[model samples]
Target: MNINLLKLDFKNIRDFRELTIPLFKEKDVNTPFHISLIQMPNGTGKTTAINLLRSIVCGEILEKEIVLSYQPTRYKCDEGYFGVLLIIDRDLYSLGMHFDYRNGVMKYETSRPKEVGGGKSFSYDLPPYIRNVMTKNFTRLFVFDGEFSENILDNKKTEAETSIKFLYFLDRLELLKIKADTLLENKRKSTKDTKVHTQQGLTKLETEEKKLKQTLVDLNKQLKKFKEESVSTSQEIEDLEKKNDELLSENETIQAEFIEFTTKISSLENDIRNGTNIILNILRTPSQFSLKMNDKLKNLSENMSKLKLPRSVSSEFFKELSDEDECICGRPILNDSIKKKILEKAEQYLAADHITTTNCIKGSIRNMDDYKELSNLRDNLYSYINEKQQLIQAKDLLKLRLDEKDQEKAEKIKQEIIRLSSNLVDLNLYIQSLETKNSAFQEEFSLNEYENINLCQKKLIEKRKRLDEASDTVNFSNGVSLFKKMMDNIISSSIDKIKEDLISKSNTRISQLMGNKDVVLEKIEGCIYVDGKKGVSQGQSLAVAYAFLSTLFEDSPHKVPFIVDSPVGSLDLKVRREVSDLIPKLFAQLIVFIISSERNGFVEGIGKYEDVQFLTIYKDERETGSIAFHTDKKFFMQFHSENEEVQV
Candidate 1:
């Protein structure tokens, strides 16, 4: 598996957006490392660097490359909530933590810019259960532990509740069945929910002139029948409900067709690999403009090199010659005329040429390659703009056509009013039976009714909760907030339970890994804490964090690179030994940031690992950037030299 790095030049950052920008530029390393350790003293801007890398992996922001910027306030505080994203081989992803303060409200997004647009992208914003795959996918996220651990214990119940939905999400078949069941129940209940009232059917009135009109001939007979028997308004209301259902069904069918076509278009877009979009623009554009400009500049330089005249054109002799010469074409050429035409022209040409203008290449600056690249980028933006406009227009036109058809359909129903009224009554009683046949018309692929049904199920529960607390007074105030709170409770309860289980299990593993340490996890109002009452140093805290993090990568999907700034901060020999093994055990590539004094034993432990790599970063006298001292790891092949410090 090839590793992609998000490198920062450090000199170009202009703003906070740059911190959460992107880096896809890559370089080859001989190392088979899955982890890259970086050490930058407090002032080195490490946090700003990684966050920018995260935005690129997330793909939530930025267009193509990282734009060095610092104006976070200018983009609006809410805009800074975006994160950086970095992509790895296979389907691995890395996203930077994003935090933005807006007015009095603070917003935190789940994933950064680069990782967005996936159907799974929303998983980041969704409650915990929805974000499991993301949480579990990357192997090294486990290595990161901050004060947030305190929140986990503090909100165990809340965490568990959030985790429950994730449990359900994992069970796709169960979720599917639940969705179908909910839809079936909803359809069954709706049949009974509708009621209609009418004093009587339009009492068909017929005149003596009805006999002349065949259509009205039956009107009087129908009116006489209504007087003979009163039609039940309850049943008529039921018929109206059935008619409502039919209309709803038709609407659903139309929506389904639209969605099907939309999906087809999406598939087609992917198949073309963006060729359809840029093909026309690329074909129309030419790079000759740039090349021709370069040629003109070269010619100008050649002319300037040989532009000087002879040094011996004496004024006395030239004057005498001009006066003595006869003008064969017309008259004696005057000395003043000679000076006016030839000397003046030469003088102006020499004076007009500024040193800078003459010395500088007169060619247009854009190279052929630059023009080609810009042309392609411009075409892509233009095509997307044009395509979106077309789609919007088409959607509007389709809506208009559908509206027109709907009006026409309503009018058609008017002509058969009597017959429709009779038929609607029968449909009220027959809806349940007709709906049973829906299962028999299943398509080859599963229908997406589950999404609609799930929505209805949520709404139904909400309505039921309100109805239960329905006030006796007819003018009772609506309980929308109460219903919302109830829903929030249900959702919270489900996830909290799962979060609790994860923390508990993960902590259990951490304790086991610690072996003889007596560190306890603390609980607070909002966060879970790992505190060592018996003097826990900052270095110890980092080690504890590493221990806690290892459990997270037990069976991770992506073999991410593990990076530790200071792996054995304040640990004793024993803790370092365990950490040495743990880092390599958890990640495919391990990079340990050491302070030179802590190298021998740590390197020995990792040297046995298959693809481990290491390097030491220190100031160099000759090089502008930090020099890297390479070790045996293959990744540092570029920096490897016989001399210990090769100024690399």
Candidate 2:
């Protein structure tokens, strides 16, 4: 499919309102597939016409909806493609593109919501014909302002590539390979991390396991020594009992005589018996002592008793005073001796061997009496009287056991511990060496597992070699021609001819882009540069650039209509005549914007040529809008006659 016609359907388009704007005159079948025009006013929608042409070819403005005098193929290129013309304005206002084509459909979806903060914009859904042709090719052609000359060229490359990518060039081989190469680099990094992490974990595990096994071996040796030393302590205890027996025999003889004397009155009397013995014997005599003396001995015995007392302070006070004084409630005793009487009563019920005696008893006390019974009535007492010596022997043997029985065992345990510890140190060092060996083995094993790394490295080296070879023009014809082909895709051979033909024709028509400065159409390398090495003024630059672009479309692949707004405002007298004649001869269809000031020159130029049409723009008063009309010789003549009457 290709575009057949372009309809200018803006919110307020005056001349083209619902017009099936045929791109060519009805009878001009052999018209050139190009156009040229000159605009005589400054802000007269000259650039707008170019942008609308691009929008139409892009299927932004649907072709089928508009009339076509000649059907434009909607899907295929009638000619190869279209190009852009860049007018330098800091605000980018003068930028414009023009496209020519036909056929099928290309579709696009974009939405600009009615957002609040930014300038409102509307969008068009492109047809598939546009998407197919635009997405694949014909995207790189451009013209630059050429003010900074080389810089503009460089900057345009970037902008052109950006537009192509946004147009979906990445679906093609070039951008696809770029994405794949990025993924390949990421995969290489991931594989490297995986190998490093696995190797690190494996090395740590092997080292720790080796250390643990060596610790277990050292513990086994320690257990062996612990068993042997603990078994020898029993023998040392047996020797202690034998030394106690001999001392026991000598103590029994002396103890027998003492027991015999204890039984006889005179014999026992000659001895200062244990005070306990004397008191107990005296008490057995009974009636000889008064209650006072008996009480004194009882008191002495209780005082001397080794029984532990309760730790209560009230208990101690009650013990000394009995519950005898004041009835314990602070009331005076009815009888003055009542405290003494309560004491006598508590003493009567006192624990046995608590000698607060109301009566005396002989050989009958609590724990003191139990001590004597333990002696077996002096039989074993005498037998064990030198028991201290026996005890000393047993104690000395225990001392020997402390120093010798467990001592030899402990010393052997110490030696065995030392030997085992020394063995452990050697084992530990060996284990360390083994651990180091394991780490080395694991490191080697891991390295072997990732042998692909080496392969990849080798592959990368090979790739670099290939890329280097391919990238060098000396090595490959394709590489040598890569830049040339890229340029060809960017601009067709027709554009180059445009330079020669348009500049040549322009020099013929406009006497070159200078006044009395003899100039020639020159090619510098592949590009056309003006003969003036020094730069021209902004006006001359504009004139030349416009001529350059107009000439570029002269031999275009298909018929293109030209519409220019303000073209003669900056031109000198000679250049104006040249442009005036140049337009109709060079282009097939031409619509120009003009002011009253340049009308005479334009009329003279139009008269100079045979066929041309000029359109007039007016703000219509009654309609409250703009109106477009054609001005002819009869209308001008009528206006001239009316003005003459008003003057008369």
Candidate 3:
């Protein structure tokens, strides 16, 4: 069965309106090129789309869980719905999940293949086989994000075991083996003629043994769960501690800036104070003192105009005028009396020595020009005072904002850091206690299980001995025991063979994808090995994970599409290319969800393929909804080649 259509109606889902994607088209079929690339920037509903698909797959076994799991802050009482439309045997069947939180339980329904004449019937019950195929276990194998990718790189033993079970359906074989064992035991119980009491005793011992074995399994499962929870909690604590340290560092930097701003504000205040004093002193004296100095200079100019002859002009010029027969104004001065009058007027002028002394005194007097200097000083002081006040105001405003805004914010972050640190301590202590408890439980369970098995074996031996002494024939019990042993051996050997084959195929895929790395992966007993050693680099581990997945799907009868988000984000440039090159060839229909940051390397690695489909998911500028549709390849190529920031 291959899924071709995924439709999402957000008439119900909060913050999301509608989404749909036709992953495959009938015409563009090409070998190893059935690639659908969706380039979504961060927060453009990429994770939401992934979750919707995950929920659709998980809805097979889970009821209300798929809907409740996506309860974001934006979620409201709205009807959200998702559908997975598949083509099974060239007939269309649609599986849908309708989630209405307001109504309580989510609804799951699917349609059978349409009748040849063209009618459809929808039912709540999915076919058992189809339901089994869409299990949550392999959901991670197909749909995964960065965290699971990192888990792959971690190469967890549990992850490997799950992969093996799903890859080859080993669990079904184990169930069959168990059924065969039960059948053989029932046959042994059916022997009627001889050793009836021994048979009853043996049956009772076997029942007790089965109960003890089941108890052991349950105990182991609980211990495994506890350990997993402890690991997860410890990781959370580590993350919180790291975040707390970062917050502390950020708070320190903000405080340092606050101090620097406070210093500047103080300096500005000092400058403003000094400027104010200087301007005040100038204002106190400018009006009255400037007027007096101007009035004195005006009086001195009038007195100088009144002065005659010797000081203002030379005495020799007056003597020349007296010697003249006529006055200088053309009046005749023939008589001595007229000449004497002119001479008397001239004589009233100061002597040359007095004139020189008067000029020297004028020069010595304080100049009124000092008022210009005083005026300029006053004006400059006022301007300086104004500028200083502006600077002070700016600094004070910034200080006010910092005190009102940044200080409170930083203080809140500091408090959060403290809270997170305390939580980390508590979480670590809880994890430690859980681990200790799990350890004790594991020890006790192992001892009890061992004792129970030993007792069961002894009781069986005694029953067999009694039957042998009471009668001559123990053939019926022996034959049944031998048949059960054969089934156990077959089951064990088959599991071993499956593991061996998976390891070999995984190695081949690793070589195909990363041959130049000179790394070999082997499964020794149940542990993974790298080049016959126990450890591998993160890149090698991720490569091995991809290799294992490729091998699993290659042999799987169900051709489920691979939908991976940011699968190659953690790899170096070289390994990213290697993995990208191997992706298209590995899966029949591959949907590669990638962000723009990783596009360049992926494009280079994917090289050129004509049949590749490209879809870009972005926010609708006019509406509060996400939109995704097939786009021109060159658009993304230009976006990457020009290194433009994607505005999604």
- For residues 114-189, write the lDDT of model 1, one tens digit per residue: 4343332432353232233433313214222233222233445333222234333433434444555465445435
Those runs of model 3 whose alpha carbons end farther than 4 Å from true positions after fitting are: 1-11, 26-33, 58-65, 69-77, 115-121, 124-129, 146-156, 176-491, 509-517, 524-528, 532-541, 626-630, 634-648
Q: What is the Å distance of residue 53 in model 1 from its true position?
A: 2.2
Clash pairs (backbone) in predicted model 3: 12-79
Alpha-carbon error at 183 in model 3, in Å?
8.9
What TM-score against the true fold does each predicted structure earn?
0.32, 0.34, 0.48
The best candidate by lDDT is 3
Model 3 lDDT tens row, 1-648: 544433334434534566666665555421223787888767666687777777676564344665665443353445666676666545566667776665545676677754533334344444556567766777767887756655644534456655666656665656765676676556545544333434565565456556655654554555566556656655665665445334433454344554564466566567657766765665565433466755676567667756532266555556668889877788877888776777777776666788888776566443324443457656665665666566545433433334455556545644665675566566544434333434465465553333333433444555555455333223454655576677668766776777788788877777766555477766633335556254465556666666667777777777776788887774667667656776677776677888777776676767565557777765555654545444677766553412335332
- Measured on C-alpha atoms, candidate 2 has an lDDT of 0.38
lDDT of 3 at 205: 49
lDDT of 2 by residue, 1-648 (tens): 222221232212222221222223347532322322222232333344444444533435435333221222322222122212211111110111122224322222232222312222223323333345532123222211123122212323333223223332332545444555465445435444222223344445445445444444554444444434333332333233233322322244433443333334233333424534544564554332345544555565575454422212332354465544455677766764676666565543445344333224323332132112223434433433444345444433432333355445535544555565555555544333323324464465453211223323444454444334333312233332454455445444434443455566645543443454444334323333444446443333444444444444444342334445445554555556655655555444455544545554544665555454333433233543333443444443222211112211
Best by TM-score: 3
Model 1, residue 335: distance off in Å is: 73
Clashes within 3 Å, all models in order: 62, 35, 1
| lDDT leaderboard ranking | 3, 1, 2
* Candidate 1 positional error at 101, Å: 24
Question: 131 in model 1: Cα distance from truth in Å?
Answer: 12
